[model samples]
Target chain A: MANDPISQFQIKNIVPIEIGGLDLSFTNSSLFMVATAAAAAGFLFLTTANRGLVPSRLQSISEMSYEFVASMLRDGAGSQGMRFFPMVFSLFMFILVANLFGMFPYFFTVTSHIIVTFALAMLVIGTVVVYGFWKHGLHFLNLFVPSGVPGLLMPLVVMIEVISFLSRPISLSVRLFANMLAGHITLKVFAGFVVSLGGMGALGIGGAILPLFMTVALTALEFLVAFLQAYVFAVLTCMYLNDALHPGH
Target chain B: MFVVTPAYAESNPTEGTHSEAGAPGGDAHGGGAFPPFDQSTFASQLLWLAITFGLFYLLMSRVIVPRIGGILEHRRDRIAQDLDEANRLKEEADNAIAAYEQELAEARKKASAIAETAREKAKAAADAERSTSEAELAAKMADAEKSISAIKAKALGDVDAIAEDTASDLVKHLLGGSLTKAEVAAAIRAASGK
Candidate 1:
């Protein structure tokens, strides 16, 4: 278990609670989730406290994140989609911070959990559905029936559209979860290889360098994946929100 | 295998407690579920995620968005005002240059006009002086001509008196007596006329 890669993801109870037979134990996963939220919010708050006209380095990063998410939302859903800015910004920051936090040794990756990712995905799709219906009423169903579909093939097209639409939450959640799960697992395996091989002999020590280098390279790639997955999550959220805004096409 | 079911929520907490009783290292490969799929932690994680995420969303919407947006907007307005000021300054400088050039041209025209008037005045004075000198020279020439005519008339009278004296003296010497003044004058006049 010293080199157990899967063990890194274990959720140990920090404070076990059983109220009314409910397992609401405060675990390492919960701790990191709170930490992720704090870090995401703290970075933005502390850096931009000055609100400098000429931004400092850290302040530039804060402003850049704001503009980055703003432009992403505007591009995906247009200016009218800005109503969802808070939600989209929170999701992006939370996932980004959580993913980066997992890169540390012995840290839990909150986003790697399927339920967490699914919840987030559902949150986005839920917004789309609720707002779509609220704004357009019955016309929101028109999203399933695209414009210019011939009456003959309309049913088949609509069935495909409905299936695709239903699969949005699944695909969105699984993509982030799978990517983080696979990347972390692969990184842990290679790092474990370095440790195990170095333990064997002098010759094995030399062999361990390859995996050591691989671990380093994979760490870099994981960083990229972390940011990329966050961006992907935000962008997809915007596009889905677009459906709520204009559901016809 | 990735599907989430509510049954695991009830089942895994017992397993979790059982695992906690076992060796810590046995948690990963022990007879428990994978950590991500371990439904024992789902309720806690979901609850915490909801709390923190909700707080985050509220903070973003209520505080951070307005602050950053205001900063950016204020910066944009400042830049626009600075640009407008620069344009105004440029226009003012252009007007100043135009005014200077116009004054310079006007001054040059006035200088030439003054020179032209002076030149015309000098020419008129020279013409007047020349005419006065010519008139004074003509008066002097007329006075000199009148004096010369008087002198010529007086000399002619003297010549007549001398000729009469010489003729009377010659008659007294040759014919023993001078003829009368009238006869002598008449004979001399007859000879000069012949």
Candidate 2:
């Protein structure tokens, strides 16, 4: 609301309720996270409540998103990978809804926090580990070994693959968190200019037009980034799950 | 105005108070503090994320996804059924066209047979009428010949009389006096090449 660009990310306690010794207070971020999840789920439920042969506008949107996720999973990981559709689709919807909600004036961006993004990233990696081990046994270790390599150089290659495999969550989490955080910060900073400059006079208002235009353009870009990051996350999950499904490759 | 005003006021904060409240604890992050990085808030955010995400996962898997999938499957089945119906209709149309063409061809053959018999009847009637006309003309030609012969006979009888009269007149004209009837008769006989 004010020129403090970072204040938008401030997690103030909305409803203070502490458990035994662990503080379980509901904050603004928590509220938005719950809201995002609800909104994503509610949108589908409402739109698809009454099924149709020829879909309405909202029905078409719901169907299109469903097909889009279905096709993405099918392409990334074959037909067998569809078993994990709920998890991957939920993850995608949650991130997408959270990112899009952040674009609103006062709504909080849940993806901007490293903790939130990291936790989701860990969930993806954990799914890969558990599923891979459960499905393929010791062959899951083959993920850290290259397919076609000489025995002499295999050890060095294995170490590099292990590091890369371990760093997946770090990169995945930071990519989303950083993009959302930076985009929001830049938008807020420009928005701050619109307010401060408009306060001055007619000339200040005229100058404020530049930052205003920039904010508009950046918001459009952020929208693209929102959809793209969600897509990237889902596709990567499918790819990781594929490795779990077929370990050596 | 009553309903709309509060909604607007809730969204837009008066600048002085918002920034003042924001200033006291701008932390070590950078130009302004982002409270998400704070160690204290992590437990709550994580806890809520787990709960809400778990609930969302459950809701989507149990209820929402299946409905959409069923709709898609039903639509696919409908499209396939429609295609099958279209194919059946096309075959029926082709069969109808073939039947119509066969009927048309049979009708054409029957029409041609009727036309041919009609043409033959007209030709036979014309021939019969022509032969009858020709026979009538021949009978009339025979009758005309007979009548002409009768008239010719009458004319020949007059020719003999005329010759006799012409001979008598010639003798009278040549001589000063008239001859006796027997002498005249004898001269006539001689002139007639008796």
* C-alpha TM-score for every candidate: 0.81, 0.75
lDDT of 2 by residue, A60-94 (tens): 99899888999999998899999999998899999
Each model's lDDT comes to 0.86, 0.84
For residues A98-199, what per-residue lDDT tens digits would candidate 1 score against the true structure?
Answer: 999999988899999998999999999999999999999999999999989899999999999999999999999999999999999899888888887898
Report the Cα lDDT for residue A212, model 1.
99
iRMSD, per candidate, in listed order = 7.3, 7.7
Clash pairs, model 1 backbone:
none
Q: Candidate 1, which segments miss by more than 4 Å at Cα?
A: B1-30, B125-194
Q: Pick the candidate with the highest TM-score.
A: 1
How big is the positional error of residue A15 in model 2, measured in Å on the Cα after superposition? 2.4
